[model samples]
Target: MVNVGLGHAELSSTHSNGRVQEERRNEGVVTSWCIAKPSTDDESLNHNIDYSCRQKGVDCRPIQPGGSCFNPDSIISHASFAMNLFYKSAGKNYWNCHFNGTGLIVTQNPSWGTCKYPA
Candidate 1:
């Protein structure tokens, strides 16, 4: 199921047995990740990556070739990973995730396959 609000959307899935399973965004947990807004262009994302990766404690190794988070190989994916690392390393502040208004703080886990995004 998908719930589309004014400026946000929520998604859920159903198992083969026909049971609806909602996304794990609730349950009294407060986890956040910094991701590039979908409307952000590649040039902006690249700029974000450059800025975030240069910060101290922002380890961008996982997005390098042969790294766990390297499979997607998309500017958005890499930018999101790098941005999140910078955000997490910078104390998870709202401003830390703000990459010139191109970043967004999301509660959903963007992890895919073996690439686990840090919370």
Candidate 2:
């Protein structure tokens, strides 16, 4: 068991195939990780995600006009990037993944085209 107080913690148990079985906080045996998935286009949600990033000081340059992930031009896409940035950079945890309901954590990498979602 691993314990982190307002910090990052990754207690991983892997299988023979090098796949992690769990890497997150415990909730009566239910566990989950902060993985980036697809995002939604809800304006309110997107605003929340972007607001969270700016408030948390997450580097949002990549999603700017001439940035790496600006081509998408979609709120969902932008939010996805921002959400993942916080989720991974700020410490992969429920709070980071919880982008006021804009974040959708999944097992697969959501990187596409030139936008790379950090793993």
Q: lDDT per residue, candidate 2, 1-119, as tens digits?
A: 32211011112332322223333344654333343333344676467565757756578788789997775676656666677777777666667786555455554444555666666
In model 2, the worst 10-residue window by lDDT is: 2-11
Candidate 1 lDDT by residue in tens digits, 1-119: 22211112221242332222233554785777778887888899999999999999988999899998886787788888899999999999999999999888876556665677788
Cα error, candidate 2, residue 83 (Å) = 0.8
Task: Specify the highest-lDDT model's number.
Answer: 1
Q: In candidate 1, what residue range of length 10 has the lowest lDDT sum? A: 2-11
Stretches of model 2 off by over 4 angstroms after superposition: 1-41, 55-57
Q: RMSD in angstroms, all models?
A: 5.8, 9.9
lDDT of residue 15 for candidate 1: 38
Clashing pairs in 1: none
